[model samples]
Target: MNPGRPATGGSTTTAVLGALAGAVLLVMVLVVAFPDWFAPYPPERTDLRAVLEGPSAAHPLGTDQLGRDVLSRLVDGARLSVLIAAAATAVGVLGGALIGLLSAAAGTRVDSLLMRAVDVLLAFPELLLALLVVAVLGSGAVNTALAIGIAAIPNYARLVRGQALVVLRSDYVEAARMLGVAPARYLVRHVLPNVSGPVVVLASIGTGTALITASGLSLFGLGPRPPQADWGAMVADGKDFLQLAWWVSVTPGAAIVLVVVVMTLVGRGLQMRVLR
Candidate 1:
């Protein structure tokens, strides 16, 4: 009958998920940062004798069609995915925040103009927009990241702009304005700091999305070309051998799903905590 008693089922489930997600992410970071430490063989190195072999003591995850170790490639692909996703997300966040803040600060005329442009961009889904960009820019890791980042800009810009508008109207902001605070100082000191929380949460969630998008592009041959490892490219590579070597593609696909789920869970948790 104690009101302070912790809820059992939901709390337990959440705690378990949090722990699992954290563990997976830690392993991912470690593998990405120092792949040689975790991988028994170089990702690209091949052993013709082990070609398309099933899991065993020597190669727990087995070998790919090229006789390359699946486990090692997965780790390498993860590093590539994470690096591209992080870079793209940084671009999206930085550019989006700047545009959004500018729109919020520049009065109704500028706001309307900027928002209309955003609306035009938002007419297309992020994936479609990114594909369009990739088509024009040609395919590679850096180009894919840039395309994804550009596609992501509208979402962040709109979200930040809305929040910034609200913050700009608050009594504190009005008071600062009346006290002759310069526009730059007022925005830097007040507007951005206030609106950054939601932007951060969105950025965290969007990184996973960007990763998935990048993978999708790689699958379509618009991302990092082989024999460079990439999750999507790995899946694409194994597609022809799906029946014979399920682990080749399936493992990387599972990794992608797991990472996205973890990021979503963590981002949701952060959102709830920050909003509260």
Candidate 2:
């Protein structure tokens, strides 16, 4: 019945969502780092006897065209999917933050040049920009991650610059300026801390986008090579077999969707709490 009570309830829900995301993230880390622990079968182990089988007690998610266990491949794929996403997010945020911070702190001429560059990048769709990078670098897991990261940089840079500008205009920052504080010192000690909340929230959201982009690249044969399990690769492998046996593609595709959905949910939760 009370406005404060509804706000409190929303906070409680956000807290619960955050907790759930943490648990899921932990499990994913373990699965990615040591896939054998959770995977019932070796991702590469093949059995002609079980080729293209549907869900069964022995093979919960079923077997692929080559008889590789779907669940095992999904587990193994966590490394490429989740790790690449995390790495891309880190690269994008760090690179963008550096540029953004400098652009905001630097005088008008430098800021104009830097932001103009960022504007050019922002003109391209994120996926298209990633594709362009991949085309130049050639396909591979590392390259895919880097490409996605690069594609993500402009967005973060713009966000960070806007946030930093707001902080720079704050009363405390003006007071520091009046007190003869050095620009560099105050920019770091004051502006960065104040602007980081939104960046963190954006990074979480960006990770989900990176994950999907990585998978899409992999689907194009730009990801890990054969026998290397990655959600995108798994989906790629199963595409031809969909008419014959849907599980080969469906299982890994489901994993990609599930992980991305969870990441997005966590990001939204963080945004609610951190930016509140």
What is the alpha-carbon lDDT for the whole of candidate 2?
A: 0.87
lDDT of 1 by residue, 1-276 (tens): 677987688867877887887888888889889988888888989889889999999999989988999999998888899999999999899889999999999988999999999999999999999999999999988999999999999999999899998999899999999999998998999998998899888988998999999999998989987778999999998999989989999999999998899888878777877878
Pull out the clashing pairs in model 1. none
Per-residue lDDT of model 2, residues 114-168, tens digit only: 9999999999988899999989998877888889999999999999999998899
Worst 10 residues of 2 by lDDT: 2-11
The CA lDDT of each predicted structure is 0.91, 0.87
- By lDDT, who's the top model here? 1
Candidate 2 lDDT score at position 232: 88
Alpha-carbon RMSD, candidate 2 = 2.2
Root-mean-square deviation per candidate: 1.7, 2.2
- Model 1: lowest-lDDT 10 consecutive positions: 6-15
Query: How high a TM-score does candidate 1 get?
Result: 0.95
